[model samples]
Target: MSDHEVVDEKPEVESTPKTTETATEAPEDTTAATPKPEGNDGGEESGDDMPPLEDIKYDDETDDAVKKKRIVIPEDKPKPKPAEDGWLDVLDNGELRKFVLTPGAVGQPRPERGCIVAIKLVVKLEETQAVVESESHELTDMIVGDSDLFQGLDLIIPLMDQKEVARVVVSSRFAYGKTGIPGAIPPDASLDCELHLLSVQWLDEEFVLPIVDRIRIGNRKKERGNFWFGRQEYSTCIQCYKSAIKLLDATDEELESLDTNELKEHFDQQMKGEKKSPEDEERVKELVDIRGVTYNNLAMAQMKIDDFSGALTSVEAVLVTQPNNVKALFRKGRILAEKGELEDAIKVLKTGLTLEPDNKAIAQELNKYSAKRKKELVTERDLYKRMLQTDKSSPPTTPSKGLWGRSSVTGLGVECNC
Candidate 1:
């Protein structure tokens, strides 16, 4: 009956446990706190949008299975093709390749045989830029590529026309191989060549017959060494002379110091029974003559090798037999010139020229010596003049000032008044 009047009866209902309000302090302003990069936990932060760490799943359960990968990428563009179908290819292949004989190519359907070529070439080692050999020759005979010729040479001869030039690469198989030239090429070395073709001549059957005969005869007479039958038999003489030279080549200074007279005596002993009949005697004389000639030739070889003293010895041996031999006299004079014995050189050269008046070489040498003598005389005269001029020069001297400013008269000298 009094629901509206209950408000006064409830002791204010304990004010419903009034609790005090606590402010959250705006959550400690967490944005101002140490901010972390995105996707970061309190642990290690993999800042990548997708972290590298992932669960690797493999179908193979084996413990030692290796991981495999397959990747694809772009490649470079293709290169241009080389000029591989010309005479260069023929040379490389050691034969002519596919080529059509056309008027446009060779100006004739068929190139003529018996053709000659004038050529120039520079030969160099493949591994270096240094030139090994060079030649410029006006050759009158060159045949093109065929099975009959050296394959490398065959390939190139046909490619060139008159005045055409080319660079050729020669392999070791086509050039000098192992055991190269004594002082020139190395073993198994390839060569680079630049060739200039100056001219060509077509060879006909008649023009080629002589070479064919030579080749056939050379082939047929392989076993027969160089023996001129029915001619003056100089074989014995040639053999002895060659043997002597060979011995000389094998000797050193120790052997050379042996008495030459004793060597000659030994030679005579060896040659005692050589002349058994009149013919034998004649051969022996020829042999001796050839031996003398051989000695002279050896001397010339020695001169070429720059062994001047050895050359003099050889020339002396020759001169013992033929004193008036102009060649020996001229060679001796040249040796003297090399030794710087100018007076002796002039004397010998003059003697040789008198013997051989047509010897232009000796005349030239004499002229050189005369000019040199004149130059030396002029040099000496100039030096003498310089010495006399030096002697005529006067040196400066100080004048005495009346003996320390006091003029005194002495009995030893007379004084002049001032």
Candidate 2:
């Protein structure tokens, strides 16, 4: 419940109560607490497997009463199955379950985190099977990564396809929870919802999409890169990361659209003296975070195949988005050293060390590159000094062989005139 984003505590649709926010990043953390807004870059950890079915239990029939009603299956009759066809048991103890009413597109891919999806939900309180009151226009679309819905939906959406429709029932832990919506949802109320997956767009035609959606898609790509990296497929990992950065890359024109000044100033301020709805600055932070993570992943993949130049470029991009990213600084240092730019490498590693004085990786790399540079400098200096010591007017001379075809030399170890 803490991991997914749920609908605002006070759902705006007033009638349509928000369920848990879904997108599969684990409950997908919940609370419409992100006020109105909203990286898992690693390979996603699968949730605990759905628990096995429970043995039959007599309802209100104690052990003594069971003897009177002995319910037995005939030996010839097939044993009753624990499961019902077409239903997905989502969590332990039957906290959540789903039955698809309509299958999705044939071979349609499941949405990853950060997708912009169109969905329609018909929600009702489980106890009464009465519709939850909300504004009719609520819950038409969602960003899979942000919590503005119920936690159960977070876990359920990934199992759906484009244009798929399903019925999901979730207990209070995933719905309004113990802290129910006042005057609307009661405490400990379970919810029944019919969800329609209208459509999804991840990469193509992403310009007009919400910033949160773009960031989510970028991070999903980074996670894919991590998967490829673990498989030792450096080239594939690099490609995945490249695509991710492209998603995070916001052009100048995009910035103008985000500026409340030139555009949405009226709507944001018109409602009241206090700004109402639509958080733009928070989205910028999300953008920076995704850019940093994606560029860092890209740099690492390039480094794996000794693509030092490319790695340097990628790491620099991370620094631009996140100047203080220690991992980026470390990577940049290494790439510089590989390119024989030790002085620059040392400077970067030093900057990283300042940020994390206890970081062993940065310390060791800094030492190794610094030592190599020092040795090269000393050798060059000695060659230049020896050249300066030689006389410009000095004539060349030939050496004579002494005993075993070795050159005869004086005490100074130079061939002598004798």
Q: Give the TM-score of each candidate.
A: 0.32, 0.44
Displacement of residue 11 (Cα, Å) in model 1 is 99
| Local distance difference test values of all predictions, in order | 0.48, 0.67
Candidate 1 wrong stretches, greater than 4 Å: 1-243, 246-285, 392-418
Best-matching candidate per lDDT: 2
lDDT of 1 by residue, 70-129 (tens): 222235544322254543354335322222122122353333333445555666776885
Q: Report the C-alpha lDDT of model 2 over 261-356, residue by residue, as the tens digit.
A: 232543233223444334555555567667777777777677667888888888787776478888888888888888888898899999999999
Worst 10 residues of 2 by lDDT: 2-11
Question: How badly does each model clash, as a count of residue pairs?
Answer: 8, 26
